[model samples]
Target: MEKTVCELFAGVGGFRCGLNSIKDKDFSLLSETWKTVWFNQWEPGKKNQWAYDCYVKHFGTSLDLNGDDTTNVDISIVDKNAIPNHNLLVGGFPCQDYSVARSLNGEKGIEGKKGVLWWSIWDILKIKKPPFVLLENVDRLLLSPSKQRGRDFGIILSCFYNEDYFVEWRVVNAAEYGEVQRRRRTFIFAYKKNTNFAKSLNLENNNSLISEVLEKKSFFAKCFPIEKLDVFSIRKTTISGDLADISDNFSFDFANSGIMFEGSVYTAKTYPVITKSRTIGEILESKRVAEKYFISNDKLYFTNSDSTHSDETKTELSSEAKKTWQYIKGAKRKYRTASNGHKYIYSEGAIPMVDEWDKPARTMLTSEGSFNRSTHIVRDLLNNKIRILTPKETERIQGFPDDWTATGMPEKFRYFCMGNALVVSLVSRMEKILDKIFSEE
Candidate 1:
């Protein structure tokens, strides 16, 4: 079996970087076991296209590989038939409302702008029928759109089922699996039923199949070990309908881990086999960060209340900025008015003013540098100052190389890329299992 890959929604090559174990700043060397034949990355409504530029800087454009037009175009407009055939398809597609509707010609069609990207993936599956697929998304995909709890995921399972594939998924928190960040994402691993590994599984009995796959047999189970399966916690359901039908009415309490085969879904909550995770202090920069990252003394101190009026006013401006951040992070209970002219009380709990050093950092958000509750602020032991995480530190949090996104992009976007990236080590851990599966053929 060939180990060619087609990377979709390739955000700064996170999937590619992980698969190839690219620790260096550039892609001068790649893994001999797996090769990426094609990739696509495009950010709509953005002129600069920083992510695509960063990707091209590391890995050359599609035109450089196979004479294809470009890898930096909107995937929705690209023809699926143009994609090269490959043994593996991998990506971290955006999470969106995956509702479906019947077209005017009575064919099932995806509804909404972002939801179409899922169909773009389905289109490739229908056309190329890759032997394997590995994908990542926010953990919320298991239960999306409050009105229809699990409809979105159910539709995805149905699509794979129709294509004669078996899927095993797990919601893994990187921190739980010995990574620095506490980011949680859903990982979907699917293989064609006719594949060598799939045939080896005991698929005749759904009960045994679920237990074996979730506990011992599946690649996900092998890489990220789970606690012993308890039969009572398993939930079984049959997904038997078209995409539109499933979208219109399909809801199940899909657990954090599960398998889907031949339309039969067996899902159950499974705990990770915990390991010691690296702490925020361990990944922080050894050298002192730029002065701009540090909170100035004016911002850190409160203006003296007994000072002269002009002096107090001058100092208050900078001091108020720090106070606002404290107030945002602190508990709040206040009265407010709604848009409909209804008076109400809005309450919120406080979060830590400074992130803990000994523990793995909280999930890094796209707004890491901003003065918000979600941003990570820590006491820089080297400089003896409070500061936001630099771009390199953010990269380390997500298991990327020191300056993976520092290739000519703006500093702020570097944080956004890491916030959107997967833990590279997570994919690196699965490489051996994937290699074994491929070699079996």
Candidate 2:
């Protein structure tokens, strides 16, 4: 059976491309592996919805593609029955406040300041009741809303539990599994009560359920194999049924990996056994790059006229430029004042200024351009010059086709789209395992 999929928050088809493009034994493309029946992509408060434009341009506009504001457009009002029954529902929901980048605020989590897109997903699950569900979000979701840890994730698990779904999740760093960049995102795979995987969760071995689910039967366990968990390290807890209670008092003790079924969450630490990977240099496109893409020597410095030496204008020292780069990468202690008139010292550890060609590139940020500290800097090995990665290279790092998000829009949005995207290879790996599991059932 050809597995059908409904992609929500489909940012230019990362999940679509990954699932639809299966590889043969010799690495040839297989198109009929999975079909994307329905998809939705919309950016709130943007007059020029480039993300939707790019998606429609690439995948072609159809009735199945909902380009409207998902939050505002009620699915029930607009054709609840219009959504085709799909075998799987997949999405990389917006990770706004769920990210660690946001400072601590007591009033945050599932019902935070931003839109509650999770409720929209929950609504869809209730309507369609897909046998399988796959979702992606920032790893910070494991312990969010600094005041109440794990409340956000707990609400999500409880939603699934209410639907009789058995869920397993792991924080996967794509580079650890041989992907091009080091993008860490939490992936949750759930099986409804009717599925064999879910049925197995009810087996009569109370002591071994967690170990069996994580080490033997879970989808992620099969795709990204992990080291055995120490028996003592395994933690088990019964989550409260009331989300309000969990929201106020939930502890953030979830390990890097875990499973939640019924009302209990079983978790433990696990390590990845990375076998192979591609480095930054392997995805470079020097021959196809334009001269403007490289940072010019003139732009790297400034000139200062010295009265002491009228004949010579002191050129901005390369050391000065290097110092700026060092500051961005190095950690330092500094006294600061908060907006509330409180004073304190702020500090953070530094990262490598330049990404290494021998290793995978660092995770990209929405601001992937010159002067952005989170942007990747590469020293052109051929010319010994430094420059930010091109939009095409950024796409390549996320395993998207070059110019995949290039829909005649400005280049900056391309970076923003890729920054919010999930690694295509990661989705493909999970889809392959999912196909096998579903086929057997």
Candidate 3:
């Protein structure tokens, strides 16, 4: 079997870059071993489609080896059968309510808008039945929809159970595993029961299977090492029933790490085996940064109080901008009136005015370079000047090549793409285990 891949939600091709070891700034080389047969990228309600444009600019508008088109349309509207079959499927899908309901004909159907994407993935599984699947999502998937905790993830496990696949997941903090950022995400790796690797495991005995697959031999265990599991920390349960039933009634306390096989779930809290971590100071651009990135101390008055001015003339942060950031990051307790005419006290704690260079960076969000409190503000070590991180620095923090998203998008969107991206080195580490599995075939 060839090492073919079908990438879904391919935002600027993070997984592709990692799989092919695309270190060159020009992205000129292609991988001979792992081939991406097809990919789809689409952002709803956006006219520019910057991410899709950047993707096509890097990898040309050519068809895959299987003669399938690299699509930019909404995946929910795409025909599942039209997608080419491949050995592996990978994506970082959005987190949403995974509730299900019975349609007019008594058939199970998706209930919400964003939840439809997961069913699109399920539709592909039902049609193609790919041998392997690797997905990424926010760690909050384990406990979502405040009314009913863990229902969303339980439904996901039940879907895989119905499809005859074994699932293993881990919530990884990149900083804890020697990465540059402190981002935490849930990674799921699933394989079909009929695969050669599944046959090698002791699947009949639950204890033996757990010890072999979840503790030692699984892909996640090999790539991200963890401490030995204490017997009392482990929680086991079985997920049963159709999608609608699971959606309405199923709930479990899913730990940060776990496995699901033949509807049996065994979860536990596992700590990473610490490695040498890289700090924010390590990934800074060695070159001199442009003046626009530096914050200006000059006091400038504006007619309106809105910090985010549409005026392009105001490129650098003014003294007023610094004050706004300080006020947002500072502690505050105030009385406010609700829409119902009730009074209440709102309080929040303070965050450090400047980010520490000695530690890994805080998780980068989509609003990375904005005037928000979560945006990273670092002092340039070379010139000793306060500034926001450059787009190249953000890419380096996420382990992508410099100017990877600099193809044609605006500077703001460039930050948005890196904030949405995953740590490329994490995917690279998992490729080794994927290689071994494919070689067994």
User: Which candidate tops TM-score?
Assistant: 1
lDDT of 1 by residue, 1-441 (tens): 888999998988888878878787844754445788889998989999998899888887774234566688888878788788899999998888888777766443545345368888988899999999999999999998778899889989988998999998999999998999888999999999999888877665467557877899888899999888886788899887487789888999899999887888899999989988999999988886888998765544344423222222223234364465455565555566899999886667767767878989998888888877798888897965788889999988887888989889999999888877888989988887888889897
lDDT of 1 at 19: 81
Cα error, residue 73 of model 2, in Å, equals 5.7
RMSD of candidate 2 to the true fold? 6.8
lDDT agreement with native, every candidate: 0.82, 0.72, 0.81
Model 2 over residues 1-441: C-alpha lDDT tens digits?
358888888877788778765222122234456766777777766778777787777665445334433322333244544566788999998654421112255455234333667766777788788989999998988877667777778877877887878788999989999998888899999888788767755643364766876876778999898887666677887776555566556666677898877777888888898857799988776654566666654443333311111111223234454335444455545566899999886666767766878999888877786566688877765675677788888888988877777678888888888887889888878878888877866
lDDT per residue for candidate 3 within 1-441, as digits (tens), equals 789898899998889888777786675645446888788899989999999898888876536444666488788977788788888999999998788876666444545345368988888898889999999999999998678888899888988998999888999999888998989999999999889887776564355457556667777889899887676667788898477787788778789998888888888888888887899899887789998888664422132423333222224334464456555665555566799999886667777757878988999998888778788988898887778999999998888888889888999999999999999888888888888889997
Task: Look at candidate 2 and tell me the lDDT of residue 179.
Answer: 92
**Location of the lowest summed lDDT over 10 successive residues in candidate 2:** 305-314
Ranking by lDDT: 1, 3, 2
Q: Show where candidate 2 strays beyond 4 Å.
A: 22-32, 64-81, 96-114, 200-205, 297-327, 330-335, 340-348
Candidate 1 has a TM-score of 0.92
Which parts of model 1 have CA positions greater than 4 angstroms off?
30-32, 64-66, 107-115, 297-323
